[model samples]
Target chain A: MGIAWFVVLSAFIFCIGAAGVLTRRNPLVILLCLELMLNAGNLALLSFARAYGNGDGQVFALIVMVVAACEVVIGLGLIVAMYRNKLAIDADEMSGLRG
Target chain B: MIFEQILFFVAAAGAIGGAVGVVVLRNPFFSVLALVGHLLALAVLFLLLRAEFVAAAQVVVYAGAVMVLYVFVVAYIGGIEEPIGPSAGPLRVLGPLFAGVLLVEIAIATIGSGLRAVSSTGPAVADDFGSPEAIGALLLQKFLIAFEAASFLLLIAAVAAVVLAQRRRGLEEAGGETPLQIGRRPPTGPQAEDPAAAGSGGPAGRAIDERTPTVAQGS
Candidate 1:
């Protein structure tokens, strides 16, 4: 298929992830959706790399993966800390910062 | 050419299915598992695009280490699941509606102009175009600073995760006893000598006698 097909697929996946983030109250599920979004971006990057015939996109994708890993780690750690503090785990209930 | 197209479609199906599963599943544990499947499918897509090293990293880092952490956290949280349906009123309808609009907008943008800059069949490439050696060379040459920065970021993330997950001593008392500590109190007076007698005791004695079998059994 053409690169357009790949880009469209990436967009589709990203939208699915966005919907998940918006709809899901569970922080863990939200994180999972974030992962989906990141992966979709990676797919698009790889497709562009293939289209241009180079390794730069691959390298960029690798760095994105590292950053994604860090994000997931910090997110899960926050969730654990919240749980430990006996705070309600629901995203809706995490309003301690609300003015 | 036809084979490649078929493979792409299959992997795309897998990726979309897993993404949907992650969103639709109520249980966070199941959601984590679904994400694992999604990551694996993305790895296949990476391979289809000739990003061999990235595909391997996708499987190893995303599907392997990241998903494992997600699964562990889900398990630790126990049976807690997302409440049925959206927790907020507008979210029930607005969420999907907005997402649909986003999809249409993105699709139009993608189809209209995103691929116009590149040739459909792509440019010719060397055998090592996306190989580990080529990527390594690119990292050392053009992207050395970024590579080093990524490593530094990872180190910070590791330290941060450890610190964030650790229970702060002050908060433990401030938040009151955790579920594990709710019923158990310290051994004092007769209970100090006799583990059977539950104590109206000091926190220090409670800490000391925490492992005592009778105290464990009583709690």
Candidate 2:
């Protein structure tokens, strides 16, 4: 029962992140979407970790959380510096990164 | 089955609603608030699943610490101002969808592989999960590498923040100077007099004196 609820909720959140990445032009929004995706990952991991008797999944989830934090700080700082150089935080504005 | 299932559905609904609010809301402040609410409800759901330690950690780390950092950053940035178009490119959206599909597929496979685990017919203590004690033992012993890595990662993040902030215009880090630096150097007596009290000596000196950056430059 809980697994079903977790799966459905996780799926919905995952879709939002998907839609955000598909829709947002701003880099910060993209970053937010990325975080949303990571959060969904954590939900799924913890849910399975609980359903099963093993604690390994929960430990893995913790590691992911730490990694996500590092990603956010560096990503945000990069965005801020980019905005300073270009005066905009829009992902589309960063054509220099495009091939 | 009935009451437990109902409570689970309610919390699930709250979680989903908050998750939607995070994306659909115009203000990221409200979005972050919604995210906090979502994480809290999710932690409750974790408790219902009997994962007490994970639930507590979710509240402490995710809901408390991580969300606080996010709110601080959002407040510092103020608002998105220019407004993100609608979303990013389609490829970005595809990434999350792939994860969703992968999760669904895995769930299906897991359930099909063994109905016994998902049945919930017997007591949940079916296994000697020993979750709390096991987690503590692993934290202190087996996974000490990861525990150490997390702390090291946080330290690096703090240093990076300090360095980046220091590099910003007008702000400096250690061994840097400010206009206030002039006041801190060894005093040369009269020149070291407080600017606030210096030009207030005479009535006329007080007249046009404080208005200008300098006064009585002539010999």
Candidate 3:
């Protein structure tokens, strides 16, 4: 397959993740979708790296993985704290700061 | 060539299907399982792209470590069996519409470009293009600062997560309040003020009372 196919596939996965973020009420599931989006970006980076015959994109993808790991760590910590305070895991129910 | 193409298609199908499952599944546990499938498929795709090191890291980091953390949090928060409430009103329609628009826009841009015709015709990669040795050399040589920064970031995240999740005895003993409960107000309004109506009075107060003793003992 061509590089275009990879790009399109990445885009499709990213959009699915975005939709999940917008629609899902559970913060844990939203975090999972975010991971999906980050993985899609890594796939696109790897495909471009192959297309260019360079290793830079691969290194960049590796760095993205590091950042993703860090994000999940902090995100899950916050979610746990939120669950402790609210006794509910729904994103919509945690709107105490909305006003 | 044909075998590679077929493998790519299979991996692509698995990735897309798993991504859909992650979004559509109600149970967070099932969503996390779908994410594992998605991550594994992405690893295969990385392999097809010749990023061997990245493929291995994908399986190790995203599929294994990250998934374990996700599942742990889901279980900790008692959310494994909780059904996600449906999106209300315009959000139900707007979310899908926005995603569809984004997909169509990307499709048009991709198709309009000449990228489809560009096969994998780049110069032959080095013998160690995606090997662990090559990646390590690049990380320690050209990208040393970035690599160090990533390590530093991870350390900071680890420390911060511990602080965020730790329950402080002093804070709880001061006014029988946890740190997060310091400035929070009791629920207002008519239904929320009733003590006899337990369910209507909000569960936060009860939850805090139930958790304090266990957390104190654990700490």
Candidate 4:
């Protein structure tokens, strides 16, 4: 497997995730897209680590996983709170902070 | 060698296809399912790259734990039933336009470099290079501070999540509106005398009460 192919694949996945974040109205879907992007980045890191014959990249991917988990927790909490307050989950409706 | 290439292509197709499914699918629940597929495909790709530890972590932490959190939150929010509406105005054109530009740029950069011929046949990796033990040793030794910090970050996130999601009695007692005030008003009228009538008043209120019992039963 060539490293470049993995890089291109990851870049493609990242773009898809970015598009989802931009176009999707649901906050939960947006969060899922964010996770998708993170995963793509991790894939690239692992591919490079394999090419370089090192373990640091895998370790870094693990750390990224930990951070991503924490982020999801906080994001879900916020989404739940938002649902409680507004009785709506539409991202467009959450314009209270938009200046 | 050819077998690895075939596996890589399959995994790549799966990863990319799943990501497209996540974006194009209307329902958020279905979108999450697509993400799970995407993560699993990526894990397979990681394995193909010889990063077994990373692959396991990807499946365990992401597809297992993080996805469970997502599914739980989706269920909690009662599942977004309505299909997502089309983006309004310039966003409809601009969002895809920008994404297309990004994809084009990346494709150009990747294809122009002539890097595709460079196979991942670097030096012979140690048998333990990408194994769990090697990753753990590296994490606890070179990245020890980061390891501890990640643990600390998780602790803070757990505390913060609890605080954010907690139903605060103080706010309700102070006449301030709690976010989850579906049935915050005192039971008035004849419903006050009839406990059962009050219980079925608002769907949100009923859902809140139901959640507790289901959670208790789950545990």
- Which candidate leads in lDDT? 1
lDDT of 2 at B117: 44
Which CAPRI quality tier does the interface of model 1 achieve? medium
Going through the candidates in order, what fraction of the true interface contacts does each contain?
Answer: 0.82, 0.25, 0.78, 0.79
* Better-scoring candidate (TM-score), 2 or 3: 3
Best by TM-score: 1
Tell me the tens digit of each residue's lDDT in model 1 across A7-95: 88899999999999989888989999998999999999999999988788999999999999999999999888888877888888896
C-alpha lDDT of residue A16 in model 2: 72
Query: What C-alpha lDDT do the candidate models reach, one value each?
Result: 0.84, 0.68, 0.82, 0.80
Could you give candidate 3's per-residue lDDT for residues B1-219 as a string of tens digits? Answer: 899889999999999999999999978888999999988998998888889999999898788888998888877776556454443768878888899999899788777766633354445677788999989999999999999999999999999998887754344576565554643434322223443443444465556654444444435
**For model 4, how does the per-residue alpha-carbon lDDT over B93-204 read when each residue is reduced to its tens digit?**
7777788899999888767765433354555787877888888889889999999999999999999999888754344565655533645434343244554555465356
Clashing pairs in 3: none
Worst 10 residues of 2 chain B by lDDT: B183-192
Per-residue lDDT of candidate 4, residues A1-99 (tens digit): 668788889889989988888888788888888888888889878877877888888888888898889989999998988877755787777878642
The RMSD of every model to the true structure, in order and in angstroms, is 9.4, 9.6, 12.3, 12.3
DockQ scores of all models, one per candidate: 0.67, 0.29, 0.58, 0.60
lDDT, candidate 2, B32-118, per-residue tens: 788888888887777666667777888898788877877777776777754533244665556556656765776566556554544
Which residue pairs overlap in candidate 4's backbone?
A: none
Query: Which CAPRI level is candidate 3?
Result: medium
Tens digits of per-residue lDDT, candidate 2, A47-70, equal: 776667667777777777788888
Which residues of candidate 1, in runs, are more than 4 Å off? B117-119, B170-219
